[model samples]
Target chain A: MSAHLTEIIVFSVLFLLVSGMGFVAAKWRAPTDMAHLDEWGLGGRSFGGWITWFLVGGDLYTAYTFVAVPALIFGAGAAGFFAVPYTVVIYPLFFLILVRLWSVSHRHGFVTPADFVRTRYDSPTLALLIAITGIVATMPYIALQLIGIEAVLKTMGVTGDSAIARHLPIIIAFAILAAYTYQSGLRAPALIAFVKDTLIYIVIIVAVIYLPYKLGGWGAIFEAADKKFQASPAPGDGIILNANNQVQYFTLALGSALALFLYPHSITGVLASRNRDVIKRNMSALPAYSFLLGLIALLGYMAIAAGVKPLPGAKPGSVDSNTVVPLLFDLHFPPWFAGVAFAAIGIGALVPAAIMSIAAANLFTRNIYKEYLRKDATPAQEAGVAKITSLVVKIGAVAFIVFLDPQFSIDLQLIGGVIILQTGPSVILGLYGRWLHRGALIAGWAAGMGLAFWMLWQIPNAATGRKHFGGSAFALSEFGFDTPKTIYVGFVAVLVNLAVAVLVTFLLRALKTPEGVDGTAKDDYFADEGDPRIARRLPGTVEKVSST
Target chain B: MAEPESPHADTKPRTDSSPWNWLLLVPIVVPLLTPLFNHDEPRLAGFPLFYWLQFAFILLGVVTTTLVYRMTRSRGRS
Candidate 1:
């Protein structure tokens, strides 16, 4: 009877099909016993080159990339393009940083960055801080995925005026995701990523090519964007970058590129590969998604061209930018095809949300629960805890949806960027050298975390009705500068983190504070796939399956 | 040659001691320095300089990293 029903039916069928795949994925490349963190938490860490490529690609180019990147572009204009450079730079950084992490991880069988931190710095307190930051950073990220799903539902007209009616579909989606994740762990996402990525690619290619023709041309699209921005009274809303905002764009991209891989879920994808060479090959191949992302960012401009606006009676000042892409699809594509696009967004959220929950769970099981609560957790017990923790983490993410506005979760993500960047001095820099003292790293993390919150507390978005901790853009004028320049709070906070790390390190060294022994060999950072020592740790007599 | 004095050092690849490993820094450092290429002039096909150069940098990074992987694969790991 209704036009949106065809979309609802198509989306439901695909979501059901993927849920079926999620259940069956537990047996994909089946391990003999899925009782260990390596086996359950990381898909046995046996994925070869192509599989790793899709898995990591699927994990990084998330619902955020699909929804928020375009949404931000639609809302903020060119600054939304920051995600593009961040991802472009991410591949190169991944090429360099990931293989080493893979090598060291494979050698020591380290599952989380906190595991590496504990052994590298021999500081449980420091590892605990890292683990907690990862869990906190990721919960809001998982919430953003719900926002993607919500935007899709909103466009599909499934959302009702009542709160319970609105959140019903989200609850169902997360329930399916949570059950499968609890059953399958990382395998669920690893298997579903193939479908998610394929749908995203098809939807994007078709939309990018087809949408421009539907409107006028690229020239017309650009002109419309320029006209809108030129008419808007807000500063820095134009199609081009001004001097005041260039530094913010640059630093945001650069800072986010560094922060991207440090998130536990991202590293989980990397560490799941069979070996270092798999990581290297995947690094080169993953940039192809960045190419896809560049095309996806253009969706925002297309939405503007299509004259898509927020829903009727929606506040103009508090317009949901997240709705732009789905609204674009709903208006232009046929109902069934729009359904396909919505499924793409919905499943896109599923893959990352699954993996993020798993990563957070692993950090708790190995670094927090196992390290502190139960030093004697068996492999089975550890996996058990991680499974339960994964469920708990998913529940926490869902709470973000049920309790707060979706925009609040988005702001949490920016704060997440600021907080996770604090780990760089200890994690990324430590991968190259161990010169920074453990006590110094602890001090640095506290300083970075403190400054990140303080900076966040200072940003006020008047439109969103936030007086403090409103967004990521820190006004340079806040620091008494004459100009209108703003910087990424994450970048400045990270700089403070590094400075404190260096200074405290020298002081600790001069005072001769007992720097704990480094547990790793210098050569461990360069280990490759066929290294016999590491290979022996693989499940005995289980043949390496090259399944994608 | 690589301070094999550390007892466990020889257990894994010696690729780090090779001269070419330093090249990995190029892909990382070039992209991290934002002020180096943060302009919007000379728009390519209506895309700003800030946008198009990043795609080129991605290409450059992949090539350099692939080259490093090839060069190091042949000469080191013993």
Candidate 2:
């Protein structure tokens, strides 16, 4: 820590600045009352185009964008670029669908996706299942963000020989994050998103332009990357996709794109918007971050061109590939600038972690606590429970890093996408209509999750030497095919989920199984801001005025 | 039977569904068809076809969504 004083100081200053902003963000919007879920968990649901743009962008792109994508590109070649296509398609795919969600959520006072599920289907059991799945899926994702900050810390020589010393920085960082999120709720990340995005854009733009100029041109970088892959023994390592992995690339891209907005954090960001137009306008605007992300993915190849090696892992002889991007900046840029870059990655982790915890907490509060634990809990009590749950969620994420191997978190994130995608037939499909019966939706979810786990159990990561739950790209040969071509696990699982849903819906209809009440109307999906129907039900306005 | 809520007794005709929503499919489908642009030839500034084409897809997505937003904005309220 003493050797790299400049980087540490610079990183510390920017980090402390954001930490200050996080604490002060409690008053940024100065909500009329913070005791309501609308204010505490959803930023008062008044975010307009610009704030929604930054908040959602910050929530989605994450440290995964800055650290993980480039690391994957460095390790796997063109396969890593799947994130580009995944993000490129996410906006257009979710553009119209999200507006319907926005309009309805505002109209119904829904705080979590499970809240919407509960009200839409009128089934507390199904809503509880959705809420549990969301919390389980989100825990690993929050853990992944810690790995991002740890990668940056390791690069700056902040790591130590002992396990406690090595993980101390991450714990302290998350403590600050948990504290501010507990105090400020969703607004902490919303306010700090502005600073996080500005720093990231500056860092990424400079790294792309200046690094390429310094280490030969873009042509030279690609040439060096191609040359390295040619001699590499790994089948997936190439400057372009090959036959064996092309299907995996396409399916992974499509599957991830579909799953992107389904995450509770993503919905948290969306539901916090002011209205439908904010979501619509943001669908067009958010892809600007994808352009930056594509450039960031290329930093992997740039790391190869510069011959930047990853730092040693906690285990002997293993390398932490997530450090590639940080090491690239540390090797090329001056200490002060590198510190800024590290701060960008570190804070990048915080915004999503905060949003994800808030999202998970909201799920617990609205769906679990309100539905089962305390049916008559007041809005203030719900807010208090959510705040406490947010702290526990953050602590759970920290324990995930401290007690378990970080590799487990990575595997859980891969499984997280598959788990969250199961909610599609219930949540996403439920938004359009209620043709699928509630019993069928539950059966479909069970089938999807079971098949996804069984499939994931077969994949073995040769690099990590993990036998089961190794990775997401399951081979086609598992079905007795005579080929090495593989497909994404989630993609295959979701198709089965939808198929099972349709089949079960028909069978259940034939059996005359009763369907539950859908509390929403068709026009509810189309209602926008200032709609009399929506304005009347919005939480803070109606309930507060009536009580007063 | 789960009837419509009393608040929605005055149901308006559904005019918000637009054909322009189908245009959004262009961005989603074109990007997934990797066979069209997955190649090493036609490099742009040293970016292989695969790399540069994805950047183009981002632009395509933005343009298509923006177009749909403009066209569908008025229809929803009417």
Candidate 3:
């Protein structure tokens, strides 16, 4: 497919418009004070219904989910739609956990989950572990957003041949992203999300209707996809799941739902909402995106039906599967509309990249920098540190993409889901009851982290031909039992984590080891904006208490 | 459920919130109990049971959450 000049022009204009919005977002909210983490990091905690809706939508549905989800479906038929049930389950999961996190964070002036983890369990070591995990897990996700942008750029013919030249566009994109995020913080992404979501919805709706018409119909689309998969020699790559992959499909969905909220970026978005009601409303409404995702996944089949392939002169097997949707658009739609869709994918990457970097930065500033490095750091110092850290995190993500194969970043994201899921047993469980002993939690987290890494390290990919860290699925025989099946690594790791946590809890109880002081009151978990208990702090104030 | 006696501070005798709170977990649990309905027999409108059923369950989850949110609306947050 040829990249038309009109497509290039339209994509540039729309992207420039988004960049302008990102820069202008610094003054949009106009916080009276910019010298506090509350303003710079959390957007003054003042986003209302509409803003929070767009923000959370943009935050969760990243370029990775947009480009990568459809790409995965295009590459590996039904299993890639594992994202569907996961997305469906995640809203309900967020519906239950986020409101409580919002309420408690408001009550105790908590900014990050690590902060809550620090206070709830009163173990800086455990909090340190959680904070480090958040930062580490978020790095690959930011790399994923870069992968999204790179794919769009490649399809646009904007890429250069050499390594440095090929990545120059990504570097430039991320530089603008870093600059705007440094100036406006979370508000930058929140403002641009309105445009991103609208473009994505428009593109998806049009594609779902127009493309299927061009390629006969949905029946024909699925038939073509089934025929293509049937021609392939791979096992478990079809329009439907079989007995072998059913276990993997189910476990991946369940584990991902459990892990989605554990990421600091997701929690950061939730905490930025004006109140608990925003969180509640968004949870119910976010499922609308799941329906959209389902439609997007079908684009894979549409591409098959339309017989769309990579660009004319590209080498065989050199085609990045991520370009399927973009190429499909380039082949089917007019140049201008294809540009609009490319901008949506590009901006989709930008919004989540900003949020993920910001969240990672928040974790570093609050948990590591202030807690350990400078107990007496001022509010301005904290925000300053966070701002610088966000840039550094972006730089790290850039290095991850530029140095390693982008496929490794994808595998790392699978490993990240496994890593992040381990935090659920502590963060989610700690929100309700403080039953697990602190020592036990340490053991649990260790076991979970270790098992997740080990399990991911054991799995191999047939497509990539890597022995370890290949993808999210692992053999059941890793436990020395022969079963002709694979399961989500996160699910098994979490089970191991939970088992160790429970066992250690019992051992600690028998040994009379203290489960540190619960810094928060029982009522604090449920406190809302109007509640007398959660005194509304002024916008720019750091914690009044020394502990934070 | 065995409530392990916690010898920690701030034991304020927790009040039972509502039975509906447990219903929030239904959506999360539905996928795990896949043995109940993992087959592809009953296709809905040319979509396999394995596929469309997930969408149905997702709608069911959304409805369940909306119900719980409405019932506990006053209690959750104003």
Candidate 4:
């Protein structure tokens, strides 16, 4: 392999630096005890505004911003800019939803979303399902972050014909991530995120300013991208959305926005904030990152103008579009700066991957292991389980990359969005009040998840030659419509989920079926940091799951 | 441990359920209106109406949410 020795050196040094930070983070804000779920999994839940900003931004904006968005824009044209609107709309929803969740979570000492669900519905079965959904959805997302790192590595000329050679560096990177995360818990990512976001802001600001000026100008870049799209045969390819994909773009944007905070990682970030005011302020300010994402998406058009080609895929004759952004940087930027850019994307992947694994681990330990395996498990044992689970979760994500080899890493995330959206009826709706019966919520989740998977199974990615689970787009023709309009499967599935939930709720109420006891009262949702009515817990421990 | 009840607590002190919170809907609905900006005209600095308008939507979201937060934060725990 023709490795760029200079680029590799720079990338390795920065990566090692971040890994060191991850290890040292255990002492950053030393807790009295590290052997409890709240202290270990939620970073002591005392983050002020700036740390919350960096950590949440780092958690949400992710490698998806640096690697996946530009790659999609390069490959699919304007339809891919759905990421811009998706991020734009989330803050409004965040302001309305997250503050309430934070207050209630802090009030009751809930560590995961399923922890909230368990008390709200008073159904261990429903909470178990939510926990499983979060774990399953988060696994692919953690794996997608590896795709970001893999793309950068491939661009640095670290490749081999053998599978082990292709994945060895990624395995090494994640292993180090797992080690630090196991030691430091959420603090590891919270500390590293500051470094990650600063580097990203610098890299993106320079690329947007310098790259456009160097490669003619923005007009030439757009013109070149338009010209390429115009010559392509794909109906979805263009500078602007066509009639057929316009609905797809809107629904994809809206569906993805709805699904964003539903992921356990997003909730983990929100709950870790010190108070409701931090969440409220951050929700307004977080849209600043959306502006950065808009500029990042345009880098795809710049790639078109720069004529940056993707590197070869693991499979014969297949190209990995995930490599597009890294290849663009390698082509245009100076060697050292390009290495810095590569490090920015690689480190970007690590932040969310770390947060996501911790989130999933929390769900497993709280919802499953403690609930079923050992009902009286102490806080120390719970933290121990979560730490071990994080390692196992990272290993599972590594296996996803090494084995599955999906055509596009973004598709892995989209599939995750659909799976996680099924939990909305129980989790998000339950926040308002427990109007929907526990049985109805369970039925709705099953219906939504079933239809979402079935629809995904029918889509075939013509590029990858995969027969099923190809992509998230569901053709209207599948329902016998004689048109070319396609819609986001998650959007359609959630609608059915809500309808079934409402209809079944009416039926169950009419039949006089007894509902589970809601462990929270209305005032609990409004409880703040100093509220005495809230549950009092030991400094390091999570409160017991309130099973009525 | 129950704290002493204050005299003002009898009125169901719902300071957070304010009218200003509804203004947050503007940012959410305004961006979803794709026809408002999805076009080739009015390109700014090489960005199409589609591209530049999306950035404007981001600004719209920030301003609207900030206004809501500023108006609502003074009243209750939120």
Candidate 5:
């Protein structure tokens, strides 16, 4: 059979497997009622530590991550490794931030960070901005996952000469995702994550073990990568970092660390855990994926060693770098093994896309819909809103992939990181103290967002021959900072955000402007698993398990 | 001073040496340590040593997850 046929058959089987898992997920630990937001959106908020660990791990380490990180390393050289350290740092930082968030969220029954922002700062406007930012940030992320699926399709030779024809499979896949996600709510992805993560593990392990022997050894891979980098005109374009990219490196790593936990989906995973300890335990453990990521990053070097070239007729240096892992497998491994690796990437997309859509949907429902559209909406109504909103989010993400350049979608992902980073002061900082004036926090968010956009506008993609700044991250020098030092624009934007917030807070306090009342008690921040006041139990009004 | 309430009080009562209580640390620590032992090797089927380490970690991950589940159930019974 032709390679295209082989790929189609393989992808069809995998798609069935994922969709079957999604349908089956509603029955796995099946919550009795699907009408309530807690049940539909938060998986009833009773997942044990292990479940939450897998769920969050699967949620954060996505198909885009699986494809993009390596693809980046393949294309840009050492800079791609930035994702590794950033992921590593995220867990430790979250250990402190998440536990507090869990306690406070549990006390107030918040499903989204915007909900907490609303109550803590007593500002609907701030909450609204957060909700919009979350949706905007997440939309591109969901679109990026489609890029992973599209990469597979292209490798499989499932495309037309035109862009629309090339992306038809992605559109169909997302349509299915939208349907299932809407039906099952968060439970769909939470359950599917198990299958997705299991597949990814199987594929990565087999490839890592099998690929090295075929290509000679690690020394050879690094040598090839180094030779490639040295040959390139770009100063820093090879196997290791140079002086110019160091500031960009450190700032990107730190910026990403801050940005990772700030995503609404990340917070959703944390809140779904059974207690604070689950959050604590997952924080230290999730770094394992970072280690896995480090391994994945090395795939770039492996591609170089294997002498894997982009497909014929591909643009100069514009070959689908995302296909490197799959191409590596096809070039060296048995066909069956290639099938499994393809399945892993395909499933990886589903897990995070599901979570991103759910998180975005929750933001719209709790922060926007219930807050504005229907204040007296019943729990069932709220859940229905969330379900429909998830559908919209999935469809919107699909549209982004189908309509816009895939590279632009990646730019949006970086932009999403920048936008979400604005929430750090509101979510992360607010956890420690309420000293930040809500008004100032709003002002900071605007300033940071503006600067982030301006920085993003300056970055130009060299490969596509596009001139405008196109990716999610930016270098400090790009902003015309006179200092020779480089920084991630998100990092700089966040600093500006914090500075503006601090300045505004002091001004508000001096002027004796009314700070809104905090709905949560101070003791709530320290509440743990056994706190009687916040103990887990059936709500007083629930008359039956199947009420929905 | 009053003894702090047992954090696991909301669930089944805890017993001394309950495996579930300790299972918590496995996911937390295993991922953190796996990298220290990770080393580079030649590519097999286009994958490297660091890549294989991820697979090894995944195996370790599965074992840890199973152990945690079993411990939780056993502790609940005890």
Candidate 6:
């Protein structure tokens, strides 16, 4: 069979497998009622440790990550390795943050982070802002996953060079994804993640072992990458880091770490766990992906060893690095192995895209629809709204890819990171204590968002010839700091967010502004699975509580 | 359905934390040092420090995950 035909068959099989799993997931735990948001959105809030591990791992380590990291190394050299450290740091940091979020969300029966913000800080406006930010940030990330799949399609020669012809397959794939995700809610991805992660681990393990021997060796790869980097005119292009990129490196890494857990989909994954211990266990274990990421990053070097050249006038080094893995497999492995690797990347896209749509849909259903449109909406109605919203979200991401310059998708992804970071004060800080006033949180999100946009406007990318409108993550020097030390714009923006929150809280208090009623008790933050006060109950049932 | 008990709910907080808890730092520290010890001079399998260091990290990851499971589990329950 032709390569394109083989790829199509592999993709078709994977699609059927995921859809079959989605149908089966409805019975995974056999929740009492699929109509309720809790059962559909949070998977009955009863996932055990192993299930939670695989689900969260599959959610966080995505196709965009798998494609982009190695592609980045192939394109830019050492800077691509930023993904490895960022992934490593995120888990340990989450160990500290997520346990608290799980406790607080469970206590309040919260599905989205914005729900926590609304009650904890007593501000509907702030909750709305957070919900909007999450939807906006997530859309581009979902679009970027399409980019990963497109890279594979291009390598398999399934896509013609014509713009319209190239993206038709992706559009169809996403349409199918939108349908299943909308039908099944988070359960679709949670079930599909099992297959996606298994394929990724198997392909990467075999590639790491088999590729070096097939090509010359690790030595041959490194030598070629070094030669390529040394010859490039860009300062710090080939093998190692240079002075100019260090600040960008540190800030990008740290910014990504802080922003990692802040994504609504990330919290959605964390909240689905049965208890705090699941979050804790996953945090300590998820860094295992970093080891895999390190191997994946080396594929860029492997591409260099194989003398894989970028397409003509493609900025010399910039021919879609996302294609490197697919290309590597095509060059070295037999057609069957290549088909499997392509399937791995294809399935990787579905897991996160499903989760992102579900998370975004939940944000809209809980924070927007129920909060404003229909406060008396039934559980079935809420699930219906979330299902429709997920379809709209997937369609919107597809439109983003179809309409805009592909590079804009990357910038938008970074902007999403900065935008979601605005929620740190409300979500992360609120978990520990509710000291900051809700109004202050709103003002802080505004100021931080404004500053992040202004800083992003200053970065310029030379390759795209896109000036003053490039990367969204900012370097500290732009803020007039003299030291070599640079922090993520999100980190800086979040600092401003916290400062405004704290300062405004004091001012509001001094003015005798009402702090508003807290709907939860202080002890609820420490409640666990069997806490009779906080346990999940049948829909439409109510439990009496002793007034504190 | 029966009420599922929280595993750590009744357990007392660790009064004397093990030094082993610090082993969590190994994955983070080792990866960072791999670049520094890389010496910019490439070698393979003889003193292939880069590859060896990364392999060591995989081992470190296995050890840390096992340790975390042991530390978090109940003394008698497991």
lDDT of 6 by residue, A121-221 (tens): 77888889989998988998899888878777878877755667868989888887877776677788888888888888999899888878877777777
* Residue pairs in collision within model 6: A229-A238
Off by over 4 Å in 6: A1-3, A161-163, A311-318, A408-410, A473-477, A480-487, A539-548, B1-78
Question: Model 3 chain B, poorest ten-residue lDDT window?
Answer: B1-10
Q: Which stretches of candidate 3 lie over 4 Å from their true place?
A: A1-3, A310-318, A540-548, B1-16, B31-46, B75-78
- State the fnat of candidate 1 relative to the true structure: 0.33
The CAPRI-style docking tier of model 3 reads: acceptable
Distance (Å) between predicted and true CA of A235, model 3? 0.9
Q: Lowest lDDT 10-mer window, candidate 6 chain A?
A: A539-548
lDDT of 4 by residue, A506-545 (tens): 9999999989777776776776776765445556334333
Chain A TM per prediction: 0.96, 0.98, 0.96, 0.97, 0.95, 0.93
Report per-candidate DockQ.
0.30, 0.56, 0.25, 0.47, 0.06, 0.17
For model 6, fnat equals 0.09
For model 2, how does the per-residue alpha-carbon lDDT over A1-548 read when each residue is reduced to its tens digit? 67578999999999999999999999997876788888889998889999999999999998888888898889889998999889988898678687788877877778888878888888888888899989999999999999999999999998888989999999999999999999999999999999999999999999999999998999999999999999999988899988899899889888887787789999999999988889889999999999999999999999999999988776677788989999999999999999999999999999999999999999999888888798877788889999999999999998888887674344568789988889988988998899998888899999999999999999998887879888899999998999999999999898899999999999999999888777887877877777655444344563465466
Q: Give candidate 2 misplaced runs (Cα > 4 Å).
A: A408-410, A535-548, B1-5
Residue range A280-328, candidate 5, lDDT tens digits: 6666567677767777877877888888885533444556677887788
Clashing pairs in 4: none
- Model 1 complex DockQ against the native: 0.30
Give the DockQ ranking, best first. 2, 4, 1, 3, 6, 5
Best by DockQ: 2
Q: Which pairs clash in model 3?
A: none
Report, for every candidate in turn, its global Cα lDDT versus the true structure: 0.83, 0.88, 0.82, 0.89, 0.74, 0.74
2 against 6, candidate with superior lDDT: 2
Backbone clashes in each candidate structure, one number apiece? 0, 0, 0, 0, 15, 1
Q: On lDDT, who's better, 2 or 5?
A: 2
